[model samples]
Target: MTVTLAADSGRLPEYPMELDSAQSQRVERLLAGTVISLHDHPIRLPDPLTAETWKLHSGQSADVFGGDAIVRSGLNVVLASALAEPDQRRLLSWAAAMRPQLLGPELSGAESLALAMRGEGSAVLLALEDLGSIGTDLVGIEELYRAGFRSAGLVYNTGNALGGGLGQSTDGGLTEPGRRAVAMLNDLHMLVDLSHVGDRTSIEAAALSTAPVVISHAGARSLWPSARMKPDDVLRAVADTGGVIGIEAAPGSTRVSADTTHDLDAVMAHVEYVAELVGVDHVGLGPDTFFGDHTQLYSAAGWSPQPVPGYERLALPDYVAGMENPAEAPRNAASWLVRRGWSDADIAKVLGANAARVLESVLR
Candidate 1:
């Protein structure tokens, strides 16, 4: 699937005509009133790779204020799998048994304290265990959804009971159970995520889902035809359903090397491509920027036998050189958009407005 756009284009339509001009102006004014600050805040979203990598790269030094930073940044929601009671216990136990040497002394202590202080923090980490290795019965998933699993994907880079992944030997589509899972998720108001699901799975899920589904973090194949990107057809399908596709950082989804010089440009090219395909409303950022060492955790978990060659040492800085922290990401992206001639309103949508819109629909 190819997506082409005329050069020197202006902004696209914001939304359906259901919103009156006065209402639309009010919405735009409210969005514009949000000042993009320069403070470095703790990241609120869960990027498994980032959490694990931070521990490995930077020795586990307990940050009592880390949770505070996350809240101040207006990131009160976390989509995580390992933070739930049972899953957290399982992960800690597994880490202790499998890679005791990798564990920093402070990690175990912090985990214990965190569990004891559960609910003291303002942000909610929606822990979701990988059902890839587990059977596809989805019993636990049903319970989690009832408890609030607002976002989920059938598989994550490997063949699972639900479906095949991009890394699977056979790029199979949705299995019977996978199809059933999608239906159940839709029925339960869970947003299906297709970031790592194979091409066939993406297409099938998009068709099956009544609500718009998101590829939470991905790039454009037109920019780089890596498995991590969504095809133009898939992008259109997502947009047609009113879903948003988030462009990830360079290392995870793009072909751009980690060279500080051209990496940001490469990332912007992807954002532009997706915007061209589905317009600005369907394009956003979920850049999976790992602040520390992820390769070590991947190896420890026995998830990948070999390290991601050439990417083993890649960290958050490699993707956005100067923007090493979460707060910096929005600022950097906004600056780039302005340079590309985007209006403040358009830039605001790309930064967070678009993602918020999709979340409000699916999570409500």
Candidate 2:
């Protein structure tokens, strides 16, 4: 279904909404604290619609934050997504065992956050695409938490022993181990995430977990009904737990057509939808994509490994306006919110305060 712009707000705006000094300072501070999902690490995205895969090239990924030297510093904090179990382990090792080696003279902010989630300066927070890697056991979770692993999604797009993913035929809620996992995470002060879990799993996970659960990267289904988007009722459930839903900037995920997907307004529409659905406090940025190759750097989401009914036409585009990369995302959001006349405090919540709230509340 094509998303029609509000009657009074016809057509996408020509973007990069300018910000005054005070607004600029607020945005800069948000970026320094937690920008979320810079896609700092590698991810394999298969786009069946265009048959072109999505991978953030090395040089380009660094360029999104700044240059290689300032990349780690430019992004104060980011949630790095590792899909497989091994990938998750490797990320932990890189941030802990090899952090000093990776940057001999300059230590990464990830190290600081590893020491303290609300610690000094910037850092990269570790998270997983799903619980595919770590077995649903307390011992393994304990080891990961000791190793600086912060948060994780129960499933990606496939149902596992933990529970059903968004791609599952039916969700039966959390498995026995899944229940244990939620309790264990809470006890350990680790974050519980319900990003791509099935509807039943999403509801059950939020209800069962003692800690707040986050939908790290997803759009609002009410705004645009994609398999990857969550509905209002579901978002309210997350909000009730004091959890946040980071609106994604992936192609098709934002409900924009092929023509306008490259424009920034498409991305802002989802942000506006979430702020309207719940409130700005429950809204945040999670551009589960990065800047690369194409000048506009538009990326598409093949929501599942299998075809999602009615969502099988997300062809890659030339650019994605506000979210060409992480650096520009907050700026774009601040601009859009300013246009809508949102207050500085509200914009700050949508920027990163909400994310920090979850981490500070849930993380040990």
Q: How accurate locally is residue 329 in candidate 1, as Cα lDDT from 0 to 100?
A: 45
**Clash count per candidate:** 3, 6
Q: Once model 1 is optimally superposed onto the true structure by TM-score, how far is the C-alpha of residue 316 displaced, in angstroms?
A: 10
Clashing pairs in 2: 76-122, 76-123, 85-133, 109-123, 110-123, 264-322
Which ranges in model 2 have alpha carbons more than 4 Å from their true place?
1-15, 18-75, 85-98, 101-119, 135-138, 256-259, 291-308
> In terms of lDDT, which candidate is strongest?
2
- C-alpha RMSD in Å of predicted model 2 compared with the true structure: 8.2
Q: Estimate each model's TM-score.
A: 0.66, 0.75
Candidate 2: residue 137 Cα off by (Å)? 4.4
Candidate 1 contains a number of clashing pairs equal to: 3
On TM-score, the leading prediction is: 2
